[model samples]
Target: MTMGFNESQSAFAAALLDPGLPLPQGITTARGVTDPLRFAVYRNNVYVGLTTALGQRFPVTKRLVGSEFFAGMARTYAADHKPATPLIIHYGDDFPDFIAAFPPAASLAYLPDVARIEVAWTRAYHAADRLPLDVAKIAAVPPERIAEMSLVPHPSAGLVRSDFPAGTIWSAHQGEAVAPVTEWRAEAVLVVRPAMHVEIRFLPPGDAAFAACLLEGTTLGTAAQKAFAAAPDFDFGSALIGLVGLGAFSAFEAFEGKLP
Candidate 1:
């Protein structure tokens, strides 16, 4: 009869997910009828809600794979992964990794990275608000110490690096596909919410290295040097302009005694 609280809960959860499972002993309607069909309605509702949440979070994945494939995939995903937290919005946190391991999706190697970018985009959208970097703060630092300074990234700053042209695939699915992705080169993606809207951007050859170094609290000189070594044609002045344009840095501080 599953009289214990813990055992009853386990039985109910299992039945709720699998309508074919018999209702646990001692559960009945007001009329004392054990109609297992009743549980099927709620089971369908739960899957529908969870699948909708996944669709919202990974719209690009849905678009690339088409609705039929995505729906089948989402249903399979829902059966195995239930939300532990009350907030279902965060349910698909491991969906990307799941896609990477799923046998049917083996052909779509970029799917995981695309999922990662979508996750980053949503996270950036919900990140805490913060003021952009005050350019005046850096101006106050002595010019000699500028190279030794470390800049703080904005609260919404996030990055995704993928070997499989993930950024290109993501961009292709954005609003009617402006252009095709002819070149299949590895790309690093930068995500930041400078204002209200989340912005996704692709980093140029050396910019990823520069941005990554800075993200790790590297001195400006070291980041630049590493970036330059990787791509001799790296443009420091242009990169600074782009960084300011994206409002990537939130603050600046002196980094003592550092070189690379």
Candidate 2:
């Protein structure tokens, strides 16, 4: 009997998921017979392709888990969560959450946060480009008006906070030899794509607070005030220079004005 549209789609999904399953109805085989082997080959190819794509998206997660474990997790993740978009580059948005609840990786509590950082890095690399705010413009603003002026964060800016030293772990794996001590303290990371490359930096608590406030549209003066509250020794001058050098500020305008 000819399968209906829904039935045909169901059959195709089943065949793709389980290579041992028979071919979907209305599909042909080379030998003019229902050859499960041919369909199995096709199913395996699909899995392989998806697995490779996931690996590329989460290379750090894969490396931390090792080849065998990474492959196994990738298989389970792929099966449960199929891509909604045809663009492979946009895949793996749910991977960080997947790693968090994955039974096999339950022991590595920091794995998910590390994955988040990697994902942010990838996203920043593809974010919209904009010319950094001119330093002269910022300097031109009157001291009296600076308190009401808001700074805009770059399009590619992202902040990550983790209980574990995710940035340290990620950096260590990338060829730096560092101790893997579990301090159980919060570490903040700032990611910005100033030019062609993505730059990752570990942010001090005060600086992170300041940056977060600025990103939320707070005036520069307000952000600095908050930073000083967080850390009495907060160095506004140094932090501003560092942020501007990293291209964190795309533009500045009056607090009520639209970002330029």
Candidate 3:
């Protein structure tokens, strides 16, 4: 049957990533013959390119599972999940969730969270550049008005809270030899590109809660209270200063007071 340009394009795209689908209608070589062997070669290259992109984006996840294993798994994913955007960098945004449900990776429960951190890191790297809020502005706020103020999270800021020690595992993979994750407790991580480089920080549960609240536009007082509730020993003053230093906030918003 004859197909329009859009229909032809859709068929070609669907068949490109899926080997089971036959070649689109009217597709022929220079000799005007439909060659399944030649088409298969082109299809293989597409899958290989996609698998390589996934490997680059999720290096730690690739390392956790050996190269061969990763290649096989990545190929499986590439077959089922085609890139929605032309930009390869954004191709694997949902890869973490895919890993979570992948039967081969079920034994490594932390693998999904580790992939999540990698995804967050990639996003932080590509986020729009924004000048971080100056630390002095936050400090100059009147103590009484602190409760009414909310800090604006930077465009590059991301939080990853994991039930496993995923942050520790990710950090350990940064070196040549993977360091042993001695502590297996739940971990929360802050991924932000506040300056020239992206910073990956492992945060305490309280600090993570506080950052999450602030990122959601919660008032400073409420965020602090939540932090305290999460961990009684939460240090409000130090955490506030630490986040500021990390450039987590790009600006501040006051409900009823003027800016400093």
Give all TM-scores, in the order shown: 0.82, 0.82, 0.94
Worst 10 residues of 3 by lDDT: 251-260
Off by over 4 Å in 3: 255-260
- Clashing pairs counted in every model: 0, 0, 0
**Which residue segments of model 1 deviate by more than 4 Å?**
1-7, 18-26, 216-229, 235-241, 254-260
Error of 3 at 182 (Å): 1.3
Query: Is 1 or 3 the stronger prediction by lDDT?
Result: 3
The CA root-mean-square deviation of candidate 3, after full C-alpha superposition on the true structure, stands at: 1.7
Task: Please report the TM-score between candidate 2 and the true structure.
Answer: 0.82
Q: For model 3, how does the per-residue alpha-carbon lDDT over 165-219 read when each residue is reduced to its tens digit?
A: 9999998999999789888999999999998899999889889999999999998
lDDT of 2 by residue, 1-260 (tens): 88889999988987797655667887777667777677778888888888899899888888888999999998888786777888887788889999999998999999999889888898889889988777777767777777778888899888887888888888777754545656656788898898899999988988988888987888888999999998899998788777777788898888567533
In model 2, the runs with Cα more than 4 Å from the true position are 1-23, 30-33, 176-185, 216-229, 258-260
Best by lDDT: 3
Top-scoring candidate (TM-score): 3
As a whole number from 0 to 100, the lDDT of residue 236 in candidate 2 is: 85
Candidate 2 residue pairs that clash = none
In candidate 1, what are the lDDT values of residues 1-260, reduced to their tens digit? 23798888888777766656887877788999876677677788988898889999999999888888888888889888878889776788889998999889999999999999998888888888988875555556677776778878888888888988999889878888547789998999999998988998889878888888887888888999999987899997577557756878777777454222
Please rank every candidate by TM-score, starting with the best. Answer: 3, 1, 2
Weakest lDDT window of 10 consecutive positions for candidate 1: 251-260
Model 3 residue 67 CA deviation (Å) reads 1.2
